[model samples]
Target: MTMLEERPLDEPFAADPATARRQAATSPETADRPRSISSRTFDDRMSLGGSAVASLCLVWLLYTVVLPMSGKLGFVLLWFVAFVLLYAGVTAVSQPGPVVRDRIASAVIQGGAAVVLLVLVFTVAYTFVRGFPAYRHLNFFTQDMSSAGPSDPLTQGGIKHAVVGSLIELGIAVLIALPLGLTTAVFMTEIGGRFGRIVRTIVESMTALPDLVAGLFIYAFLLIALGQERNGFAAAVALSITMLPIIARSADVVLRIVPGGLREASLALGASHWRTVWSVVLPTARPGLATALILGMARGIGETAPVLIVSQPSAYFESNPFHNPMNSLPLFAYTGIRAPDTNSHTRGFGAACVLLATVIVLFVVIRILARQRRARDARPRPWTRLARRASS
Candidate 1:
């Protein structure tokens, strides 16, 4: 055939006149209609500006004229709802129905997130503002509450005892809960059986166990039954009860997500099951495990009821957890806030700020540790580097 009459090898023939006509009719240029309102188009920007102005005007009218005349409280909630509705309606005038719906949904989700973030920021700001008086004093971190009376100045006393006690108790709780929780998690993930299932169920159930109930259990067993005095040890035990379930549940989830191929590969290399878990599985999931432990510590650190029930709130500094009663940040804050004095109120807010700072510091430290571990893992070992150098 001549070149002009030959069909190209890659292109298909339409085979019929009707098919060719249909293909021409459905070309890219005419296949789908262009969007009336697109984010990429300048018209979208104009529509957005129009919607904003209309929403503001509608909200102002409702708040000032309609609500006031109806004897209704013209709160910000009414304004917000009016703004959302008016904005959606105004935008829908130029956009397709589906695009307007999606935009409205996106606005609601983003607005909700912004409101939550603002609430958290304002709460922290308010606490710091109220606590500034006590926090500004050098004595607040150095002296104990023993010498400070109801009318004493903010500079006279500090939360030294509470701070020390809280740290010690939290340390003890971590020491006790970490091993048990991690072991339980390992068993749940690696040694699946009826017993493991039972243990998992119990741990899951304990997640919702009340803080007050845990405190009462410890208080009755130690103080009432054994006739022991209120001390930091008993408080630590109570906190451990609170931390155990959280750590176990979190760690179990972390361990379960570890790739099964790593375990199989380790076993293929002639490692025992326990050795494979220790040398391979655990190392692979270290960051997640650390995160679990941090979460558990956060829950334990903020507990007030357990410490309140088991340990007497002491104003004097006590170093030994075994001997005398010890105070903690939560207990101190609770007591101070209930007092009738302004200094006590300031101290209460200050204690709360310290508690928040402690949690933030712990989270930062743990994140740093996890990042360091990941970086170390990413680097080659000394022996591996030496071998590579020799080969080169």
Candidate 2:
């Protein structure tokens, strides 16, 4: 065959015969042609909305009049079920399978998102409102529960000891877990030998390890076998164990997502593997690493079982982890809720609010730090600034 004969013809966009035919068929100018099945017209939107409203009203009527259900929870549940069925059935009548499927997916995703947002808002508001009496007290942050009984008024008792203890234990766990997790992650991503595969498997397995089991592991080995006392150190150890797998797993995933080209570029420029990872890969994935750390912190900090099993609860404020018992927000909340008094319940809710606040603060701090670093990196360099000025 001659090369000139086989040469391709130059054409405008969408100039293929098949594409041209499709465009003509779907064009608004083509009056006799049917509209695209996936296209959502105004009529389609109206039909979908009407279907949803009709389903909701039908569910309400059934729940209130036809059914024995009187609770808000049941009403909402029935509405969701009815809405899904009615919406799908109604859409299928006027639309093709793809359109029906798309509408159903949109409805489910939007409905689920709305429910989750509402639930989260309600939970936060309820916790803050319920804990108002105790949290609003002037001495709440300063006083300890040592001298106060469960029946004592909110004004007389506080979560000072629990707050301090939680911080100390969390600090210890971070110190122990962060480096180890990062090391494990680096090993997995940078050096994936057979041993690395084994390590990855173990980390994944630990991620599903129950909180109670982690507590028991530390309790048996650290508290019993070693003849150690129930203290904050033991609790920190359990928290570390829980946090380690989370941090390592999340970090490994994040590091793996770092662009291989960046690593290659760094190495091609004569950087060692360690230097490339430390300077290029780690810095590139900073935000994700921070997120991984946050997940680990959240998992460990809020654990009640491990702390409860491995560490004794203390009413008095203690600073030394090596000494007597310590108390954390989760443990304090659990114990207080179990006490047979309204005062104790208030304390529990108050501690929960504090725990929530602490987590929020940590999240904000990490986000701010990550953004700040990114902002600095994005700032114009000296030569870039000069070039911009010269251009302007």
TM-scores vs. true structure, each candidate: 0.84, 0.85
Badly placed stretches (over 4 Å) of model 1 are 1-27, 30-53, 68-74, 381-392
Q: Highest TM-score, which number?
A: 2
* Each prediction's whole-model lDDT (CA): 0.86, 0.88
The Cα error of candidate 2 at residue 10, in Å, is 34
Q: Write the per-residue lDDT of candidate 1 for residues 16-48, one digit (tens) a residue.
A: 664564555455765795543335456556665
- For model 2, the superposed segments whose C-alpha errors exceed 4 Å read 1-49, 67-72, 92-96, 379-392
Ten-residue stretch with the least lDDT total in model 2 = 383-392
Clashing pairs in 2: none
- The residue pairs in collision within model 1 are none
